[model samples]
Target: MTTIVFLHAHPDDESTQTSGAMARASAEGDRVVVVYATNGDHGDAPEDLADGETVVHRRRVEAEASAQATGTQQIVWLGYADSGMSGWDQNDAEDALHGADVDVVAKQLAAVLDEEDADVLVGYDWHGNYGHPDHVKVHHVAHRAAELAARRPRLLESTMNRTRMAADRQARLDRGEKVDWDPSAPMDDGNPLGSTEEEISWEVDVSPYLEQRRAAVRAHESQGDTAWMRSMPDEEFATMFGAEYYIEPGRTEPIEKGWPFRPPD
Candidate 1:
């Protein structure tokens, strides 16, 4: 069976970004592993956190639940602290993922790749899809790790479909619905959210696994940011997340419906 490793920035990121792929992989009898760069210690703290319960502790539990929901066979963490957002003071912390040495982190991740004998390594696109500092670091680390692995795995950078996202936003506007973030506008690191259609290599259809994806997202209940996602209607959720995007660097072909571990027809 093929082994696919998904590298993510935080506890809930896998849910929104790659959980569908993970669920699909698991259903196909492949091994799925998720490696989180941080414990998400800097994310929103839940009001229900018990006295003395650390944000890291709460998020760790949630991450485990998320992995279970996604049918992930194993979970690994690099043990770094969250770097907050791009300009936040936490970015300067010694243990912050954003500040960690890329080579050092890459070696650690490469060790996992070697151990898993991974067939494919999935990470975020450059600019980290929306330019979150830790996410960007993850992109760098994932690439470097693949280079360092004893057996190099096919690397796929996960991303959002900017073209489709914009179309969806325009559709919402046409419906007279309020829309917040614009895909075409500058985001955290000054780049627009996701990559344009021409830049993306694959549009992975994950509609068949939306239920597991939804469950994985719900598992991160401690993260207030995902609340709206969890509350979305099934059809709306499918419309928004049924397809995951990726950029396979060096692939000079039209975008197609397929995933990292499989070949496109």
Candidate 2:
């Protein structure tokens, strides 16, 4: 069985960004593993947090539930603190993911790749999809880890299709629906969200796994950021998240519908 590892910036990130693909991989009998770079300590705490229970503990539990919902075979944590968004003072904390030594973290990740004999290593784009500090670090660490991995796994960068997102936003507006997410709007790093469609290498259709993706996202109930997704209509969610995009670094071929384990047509 092909082993695929998805390296994410935080606990809930995999749910939104890669859960559909994870579900699809697992359903097809491949081993799917998710690695979180941080404990997501910076996430908002829910009102129902147990006495003496920290957000970190709660998030860890939630992440496990998310993995279960996505049918992931295993979960790994790099054991770093969550660095708050860009420019936050916590970003400089010694234990924060954003401040961790890239080489050190990469080595830790490389060990996992070696142990898993990972055939595919999925990470974020160079801009971290939206330029969050921890995410940007993930981009660096993932590349370095791939280089250090004994198996030299094929690396794929998960990202959004900005061109398509922008088009969808306009289409929503035309339909008299209010759109809150604008692909062209500047994000944490002052760059727009996602790469253009022309910059993408593959579009993996995961429409059949949408329900699993939704369940995964719903698992992270403590995170307010994903609340909207939990309440979104099935059809709308399918329209917005039915496909996952990736950029295969140094790939010069035209973009096509493909999965990491499949050969190009």
Candidate 3:
């Protein structure tokens, strides 16, 4: 079976970003593995976190549930602490993922790639999609690890269709609807969120795995209702997340209509 490894920034990131694709891969009898770059020790604390319960521990538990629900064959952790947002002091923490040496982290991740013999390695887009510090680091680490590994796999970078996001927002605004977050707002590196549609290579239709995706998302209970995601109505959730997008390595060929597996040959 073909093996694909998805490298993500945090615990819940897998469910929100790559679970649909991972589930589809596993369903097709391919082995799916998820590698998280950090333990998410610095995320927002769930209101119900038991007294003295560490955020790291809580997120790990949630990630495990997410992995199982997503049909992931294995999950690996990089064991780094969360590097909060761009300006947070946590970014300076000794163990913060953002502060870690890229070479050291890349070497560690390369070991996993070598161990799994992955056929494909999925990473974040250049700006980490939304410019989160840890997310950006995952992008660097993933690509660097692939380079470090003697045997390289096809590397794909996960990204949002910023073109679609803007279009959807404008359509909503025209309909007298109010959107929550502003995509054009200054993100982590002062770049716009996601990439333009023309830059996107894969617009994966994950609709068939919607149920699995939902279950995987729900598994991050600590981030579920407490986070902004679970508050969405079922239909809205499906509509917004039914597709995943990616920028294929070395190929700027415009995206055509197709699912995840049909990457540019």
Candidate 4:
């Protein structure tokens, strides 16, 4: 069985970005584990949570539902505090994990990888799925831990394809829908490492897992409109957005030129 470990910045990051892939992998009998680097305490609290109540407990419950939706076998938390976005007023707060030591983070993650005997390691590209500081830190630590492992698992960085994103954004705009489109965004350039689409090493057919993906997305009640997302036709959702895209680290392998996770020959 292929054991895949996903390193995420917070509770909902896994569901938002890669839950479909996780569901697909789990359905295929792969051992899929999710590692969240932070408790997401900085995120919005549920309506039922008291104003002064921390998000830690609620986020864990949300994460558990998400894990169940994705058929994840294990959910691990590194217990770090969420470091809000880079430019946010609290970005420089003394308690933030933003400036946490890279080596220390790497060591903690390495222990999890070793314990799981993971064959593949997945995390956000340097852009952190939308340039969140915590997301970037998770990516950094994932790479560093992979480097320190005696038996390094294949490293995969999740990203968006610029071309696909452009086409999709335009399609939405053509529908007269309000679209927050930024064409020249540095992160939208399709390369997490400043590389090219030709550098992508893998694609998984997560179309079958779309429902589970949407469910996982809804699990992040703090973000996204579940009802709005559900209103879209199933085919439209699958075609316009991929659950995730990945690039292999240290791989000079010619892009497979096709999805990489098709059943083995």
Candidate 5:
């Protein structure tokens, strides 16, 4: 069985970006693990949260629910604090992971990969799925960890195809919907970071896991625009964004067809 590890920056990152793929892989009997770089303590606070303790506890529950919805067997926390987004004053805060040693973070990830004996390691593109500092840190550490693993797993980075992403954004705009399409919005690029569509080595057909994906997304009510997602018809949402795209490392040639997760003959 292929052991896959998905390294994410926060609680909802997995669900919003790659839960479909994670669910589909788990359904196929792969041992899939979700590793969150932070506890997401800064994500949200209950209107009645009396103290920091309550907020932390609530976030953990939310993460657990989200993990369960994605069919993840285990959730590993790197025990770091959220670094927030770029240019934010907190990005430079002493307690933030952004200020932590790169080697230290990479070592923590390497330990996880070793313990799991992962055959596949996945993370966000350099843009960090929106240029969130924690997201970028996770991507960096995941790659470094994969490189240091005794038995290096295949590394896959998630990304959006330029043409398809643009079309999708336009579709939303044409509907008179408020869309976040600013080019300079940290990581909202019209194209894949450092790659083209032809360079994408894997496209997981996640149609079967769409509901699970939605459920995972809903589990993170504190983060995503759940109401906006709920407003859309299931079929329409799934049809427009059903599959997760990836760029596989060490693959000399681009994937012409077929799932890349299948074992070699």
Candidate 6:
């Protein structure tokens, strides 16, 4: 069985982005681990937070639940403080994820990859899909970790298919159907969200694992009100989220409807 490591910037990120792939991999008998870069302390505070729970505490609990629902074998926390956004006050905090030294964080993650003897390492896109500061840091640390890994594992950046999203949205609008997400809209870093189809190197179909994905999403109870994907109709959700895209550095083109991990024979 292959061991796959997924390094993400926060807790819920795994659910919204890579949970399907993680669930599918685990079900195929491969080992799957999710390493969160931060505790997600900056998310929306739930109004009904139990007596004395902190955002970090609640998020950690939720993340663990999501991991379990997704069939992830293990979840590791780097324990860095959350970096709110590009200009938030949290960005200046000494322990914020954005302030962590990329090399230091990479070394730590490299240790995990080495210990797990990971065959594949999943990370965020170079621009972190929309250029969130912490996510951009994840991209940086992931590359450095790859360099430090004892046996450098294969690298895949979780990303979205911008081309497909644009087409689907336009088609839906033409048919008088409303689209929930708009890729063309301005993002946090003033960049186009996600990678174009040509930039993606693989598309893993996780339709069969949508249930796992759904459970993972629901596990983040605090984010219940903002979980846009879960708000979509079942058919729409299946169509839009059935395929998860990835970009392998230096790959020229995508493998049509391919599986990202191929076990060693």
Q: Report the C-alpha lDDT of model 6 over 35-154, residue by residue, as the tens digit.
A: 999999888899978898888899999988988998898989999988987889999899999989999999999999999999999999988998899999999999999999998889
lDDT, residue 127, model 5: 64
* Model 5 poorest 10 in a row by lDDT: 183-192
- Of 2 and 3, which scores higher on lDDT? 2
TM-score, one value per model: 0.97, 0.97, 0.94, 0.85, 0.86, 0.95
Best model per lDDT: 2
Writing each residue's lDDT as its tens digit, candidate 2 over 126-213 gives: 9999999999999999999999999788889999999998998898899999988788999999999989989999999999999899
| Collision count for each candidate, in order | 0, 0, 0, 0, 0, 0
Residues 1-265, candidate 4: write the lDDT tens digits: 8888899888887876778788988998899899988888788756787676667988898899999999999999888888886677656766566778989988888898889887888877776656678877878998999987766888888766555566667888899999875543654224232224565665556777888987887787765434456566877778744545777766677555344432222
**lDDT at 10 for candidate 1?**
94
Task: Give the lDDT ranking, best first.
Answer: 2, 1, 6, 3, 4, 5
Q: What is the per-residue lDDT of model 5 for residues 1-265, given as tens digits with 9 covering 90 to 100?
A: 8889899887777876788888888888898899888877677665755555665577777778977887789988888888776777877877688777878888888888899888888887776756677877777887898888877878888765654666666878899999765432334333333345676777667888888888887776765345566456898779645877887766768654456554322
> lDDT for model 6, on a 0 to 1 scale?
0.89
> What clash pairs does model 2 have?
none
lDDT on C-alpha atoms for all candidate structures:
0.92, 0.92, 0.85, 0.75, 0.74, 0.89
Q: Model 5, clash count?
A: 0
Can you give the lDDT of residue 252 in candidate 6?
A: 77
Of the pair 1 and 3, which is ahead by TM-score? 1
lDDT of 1 by residue, 189-258 (tens): 8999999999999989999999999999999998888899999998899999899999998898989886
Give the Cα RMSD of candidate 6.
Answer: 1.7
Could you tell me which residue pairs clash in candidate 4? none
Residue pairs in collision within model 5: none
